[model samples]
Target chain A: AQSVTQPDIHITVSEGASLELRCNYSYGATPYLFWYVQSPGQGLQLLLKYFSGDTLVQGIKGFEAEFKRSQSSFNLRKPSVHWSDAAEYFCAVVFNQAGTALIFGKGTTLSVSS
Target chain B: DARVTQTPRHKVTEMGQEVTMRCQPILGHNTVFWYRQTMMQGLELLAYFRNRAPLDDSGMPKDRFSAEMPDATLATLKIQPSEPRDSAVYFCASGPGRTNGETQYFGPGTRLLVL
Candidate 1:
């Protein structure tokens, strides 16, 4: 079974500070990893995804995630935090088996402060 | 831009009532998925269809929940005899193909409150 784990339940960061959200996964093969963000009472927006090629993938809103194959981790990072970046972040893995959906983590709630 | 759309942005119903949530996938997407989100469960895939065929539904509760795709553009999820436990947000997503690694576009979701 493929599953994702987001270690932080909640994180607070000051504006302009660097941010890193940790995510680890368990999968049988080279997994398709994704990072998604959801605002309060809104649907999820894809931040970035890692399918193949380079380990570091860039996404919308200046977000990026690095896929570490050996460690089974795909952590999201931002150079500078903004108040608008406050949202819930989720880590998901797409299992390659048939009839499978993206398995998501419990999510990490980020609070940005000025 | 093409995006997934869901209907009944919000729904309030009593226990034992039936609730239906609808979704319209992107025009050319070939796969549709239904998911449930709650504080405890996070996001869970309830069911999914590939090319209008039921491919998987193992995550859904068989007794009260059902999902179907009547056409390429439409997918529906129905809950009969709704319970308070079923009070959560339902999301619909679609992807370009049935491949496992396909990127999915999600709908805004329908919030359901069962009293």
Candidate 2:
């Protein structure tokens, strides 16, 4: 079975500051990775995902993640975070095979200060 | 801009009462998934369906939980004799591909509270 672990439970950043959220996964082989964000009273929104190809994948809202097979990690990053970026973030892993369900991390709450 | 839709954004009921939640997946999407979110658990997959057929439901409690997709667009999850421990935010998501890399669009979760 696959599982995900997010070391940070919460992170606080000032506006315009860079941010990085760490995520690690345990899977037999290379797995699909994704980052999602959920604002208050809203559904989760996909930040980005990694299947194959370039190690660094860019996503919506200026978010990006690097897939490090050696580290078993897919860490989300943003050079400059906006106040609206405050939300709960989740990291998930899915099997390479089709139609597999995702195993999600516990989630990290992001608090942005102006 | 098609998106998944869920009914009864908020549901409150007494213990032992029956509660049902509904979902409408995006058009042309073949997969639908149900997830539960709480402060303690974060998010947990409860069930999923493909082609209007249940594909996995191992996360759901057999005794009190049931999930069904009666048609292409409609999916429902029901809990009988609810308990306070069951209180959480229930989310419905759908996607176009069966592959692992497919993006799933989520609907605003339904908040269920059992008193």
Candidate 2 C-alpha lDDT tens digits along B1-115? 8989999999999999999999999999998999999999889999988888888999999999999998998999999989999999999999886566688889999999999
Weakest 10 consecutive residues of candidate 2 chain B by summed lDDT: B95-104
lDDT of 1 by residue, A1-114 (tens): 667899999999999999999999987688889999999989999999998999999999999999999999999999999999999999988877554479999999999998
Computed on alpha carbons, the lDDT of every model, listed in order, comes to 0.93, 0.92
Interface RMSD of 1: 1.5
For candidate 2, the per-residue lDDT at B95 reads 88
Give me candidate 2's TM-score against the actual structure. Answer: 0.97
- Candidate 2: count the clashes: 0
Q: Which stretches of candidate 2 lie over 4 Å from their true place?
A: none
Native-referenced Cα lDDT, model 2: 0.92
lDDT (Cα, 0-100) at B31 in candidate 2: 89
Q: After superposition, how far is residue A55 of candidate 2 from its true place, in Å?
A: 0.9
User: What value does the lDDT take at residue A107 in candidate 2?
Assistant: 94
- On DockQ, the leading prediction is 1
